[model samples]
Structure formats: C-alpha cells, structure tokens
Target: MRTRLAAVAENFGRDLDAAYATIDRLLRRARAEGTGLIALPEACLGGYLSSLGSAEDRGTAETRRQRSGPPALALDGPELRRVQEMARDVVVVLGICEDGGTDRYNTAVALTGDGVLGVHRKVHQPLGENLSYAAGSTFEAFETPVGRIGLQICYDKAFPEAARTAALDGARIIVSISAWPGARTAAAADLAQDRWKKRFDLYDQARALENQVVWVASNQAGTFGSLRFVGSAKVVGPGGDVLADTGVDTGVAAADVDVEAELDAARRAMFNLRDRRPDVYGALVREPAHA
Candidate 1:
C-alpha cells in the first residue's frame, strides 16, 4: 500500500558519460533508500539532443556514441540494458528517443525485474520535437509489482485526456518524464506572475487533483544548448499537496506514495469519476451548438 517513489532531475545534453553517471548515482541512492519506483528526466540515458539531424550527423566514434544512435534501439538498446542492471526491486522509468519501425518517437521506457514493461511514446510531441519525432497513438495503464503505473512525456501532460484516460483505466500513479524548456519559465512568470507561474503549472497540479491519483514528474535540469531545463521535479498527492520537490540543479526528489490512499481519496472525493454525470456528458458531446 505504501510505495516510495524517486525522481531525478537530470541534465541530458551532449554528454553521455555525465548522463550515465547521474543515473548510476540515482540508482545507488534509490536502492539504498529502498525506493519502489525511480523516474529520470526526459532523455536521461543520453540527453535532449536526440533528433534526426543529430542521429544522422556524421561524427567521430565518440560523437556517434553520444547520439541516441538510430533511434530504433532507444527503447531496448544496450544503454537500457546497462540501466536495467542497476534495477534492484525498483521500477525505473526513463525517457529516450524511441524508434518505431520507420519513424522515431520521444518515448519513455519503463523497466522492472521481469523486464521492460512497455514504452510510452510522447503523445503530444512539442514544437522542436514534432520535427524529428512521431506522435504516440495508444494509451494504456501498466500493472507493476509496485502498483498500477502509467507513463507520459512532457507535452502530453498539458493535455487532460491522457491523464483522464490513465485514471479511468485504473492507474494509481501517473509518471510523467519531461524536458520542458526552461526559457518559458521567466516569460510565463512575467505573464502569469506568481499567481499562475508557468502555463503548464496548472496542468501538473491538476493532473493529480483531478484524477485523484499520485502525479510524479521527472524533468530535466541545467543547460542544454540554448535551453535551460527547469528542475522542479515534483511528487503531488491526490489531495494536491507537493510531497517532495527539488531545486534547479541535478538532484533527486522522493516521497511516500500510497495507492490505497489515492484510491480512497478518489472514491471519497465528490469531484472525481464517481460524481461525473456520464449520461449528461454524453448528451453534451452528442449535441453540439451551431457554430
């Protein structure tokens, strides 16, 4: 019933050694702490530099090694196998540039002892990502020994449908891995001020409060080229409380997440699925106003 989850706000740029080292550290720490689930930033294995151009760009053996190489193996490649070795009864979720047959995807990989559960391709690939990645088509919940977990990437969290579907499908914890550009933070703060902060700020909090499930996000930190990844990786409870968070540097955030508590809150809460008027909602969707 009680699960401890860890999120590492990592730096994923052009350095693969640093990235791998960061993951290694997090794995050791999570194991020592007996963390049930560990989540790493988007592109944690490599960095956010994974794109068609970078993957194809001819470079030295070292340069080629740094790139996510061929995208196809992004999900089940040697890099993941190395990472999987670090798994010690803890479910590790990390992001990678996924390759799907003919196209590439910004995907998040979930791994446990049994093996890789499934890959959740970023449904809503953002601006720069759209150029190099394909959008994900399917949505489903994953059943793990830790609990019923669901995976999502950065931009996908901005949409309500994905989280709602995850919740409706019985996901106790919604894990989102992101590389959200930090450039928007200041502009967003200037626009919304402290009242709202970032545009996706509401989305992060709402995903937990609305779905009545634990919302955990693993985000990038530090600088990647011109982008400054915000390191506010957080764990929000079903009651909308931030259980744990980290500063704007490479670090880890963790908290005790209870599935039974989330389920209890969802059932007892009046605004969740139990209180929804599906019949009326169906009618509203069926009858559209004249445009």
Candidate 2:
C-alpha cells in the first residue's frame, strides 16, 4: 500500500493546550491529504527543557514537585485520550515524559484506533537527563495497518544497534522523536565544536542507505527554556537521498515514502537481511579489536 508520512516540529513549551490544538489541525490536514502516519517531535506531549535553574528561588522545590503531578498525566489519562480523539484516521507517534510507577521515564508512545500499541522508554538518556529519567530495556517493532513501523527517541538514534534491531524485526520505516539541541559556531579559535550533531544529521541518511528503509527524523524547534532544539526535520529514502526537509522552524515536513520501493532497493543492493553472516558475527563480538 502507498504511504504518505509526516514529520512535525512542535516548538512551543509549557503550552499544552496550544500544542494540542496545533496537532489536531495537522492531523486533519494529513488525513485530508491522504497521509497514513504522523510523527511529532520529542517531548511534544508536555514539553522538554526540564530545569529548575536556581535552588534558592522561593517555592522552587514545590513547583518541581507539583510539575511531577497531574499535568504530566499518565499514559491512560486525559492527555492520551485527547490524542486518541484526534487520531481517528491516522496512526500517531509522539514523545512524552512517562510517569512510571516508581520513577519517571522519557518514552515514545504509538497510538491508533486499536489503542496504545506500545511504549518504548528511551534507552540512552543523554547528558543531564539521568537526573530524572530511567532507561528503557525493551526494543521491537509492531505491525501497523500502513506497514511495519519502529520507534526511537533522540539519543537512541545515535546508536546504530537501536535502528538495526528494528530493521531486523521487519520495520520498513524507523520514526525517531528527537529534541536534539541545535549547534552553534565555537567562540574561540582554539576550540572545535563537537561534530556529533552533524554526524546525527548524516547518520539518518546513512541508516536509510544501510538498511534500505525509510528514516524519519522529527526534531523540536525554538527554545523551550534554556535549551534550543534543532528544528531540522527530514525524511530519507533507501538510497540515502533526502526526500523532504524543513529548515529551522516549527512546521510540518512531509513526503511520500514508498515502502515497497525501499524493500525493492534492499533486494537490488544484496546488502539486506538475507546476506548477513550471523555465525561469524558471534566471534567478532567475543574478541576485542585492540589491547
């Protein structure tokens, strides 16, 4: 079946109602245009930028404690119900701060008419996120009406294993929800800016080429507090070609990714699942490359 996919960057912060309204409008637009699935930026459910800043500020402790309550809503709560209402004809994927039983988690939830399919807690929390989040252990793909879809959080996309495992499980497209911070030029001549951000941009392209699958990277835009998210949302085809891209802005970026064509390209390249040597890979895992 032909599939039209959308990747959106929701740049607003702490404005849950406004974000919901924007998403509802986008959902209607996608369905009207015949799109199959829609994915939003990381932490699009509530908001990112989780910093209390100064410890001396009055009521700071109470504010943080309160935030950890109601408005952060559980998966089966009003927040998800609102999302389910908007997701009548399309499958939706989004990131949220999950209020797990004992601790909170950075999670990606897939919602459809069939109800909540699955929730993947982010494996790698990155930098200072460990302060309030727990890492996820499960990784797998689920069958969808459109096609097999995979989910990944921001830092999880940086690991090749994360995407490859999903591909091996028959996911034709890996949808990643990211709030990757935008990069800026270094102020000093002697200092070199970390190139990982650029590497991330390129990795999305390379992952699509290597697995011969569609790679959708949806990132947040603008500043949510102190952190400025990189708003470059994009879609890459099997041959590592960029199919659609959105500049640094809060908007919808879309493209028609032919799932069958991607599989066809994998078959043509002879570099897909059928060709991997699993027996020898075991030895490679046991031996260290160097002293």
- Measured by TM-score, the strongest candidate is 2
- At residue 84, give the lDDT of candidate 2: 84
Candidate 2, residue 198: how far the Cα is off, in Å: 2.2
lDDT by residue for model 2 (126-147), tens: 6556555668876689887778
Find the number of clashing residue pairs for candidate 1.
Answer: 0
Predict model 1's lDDT versus the native. 0.74
The residue-by-residue lDDT of candidate 1 on 121-202, one tens digit each, is 8888654455556688766898987888889998788878799888888888889898866543334433224322254466
lDDT of each: 0.74, 0.76
Give all TM-scores, in the order shown: 0.84, 0.86
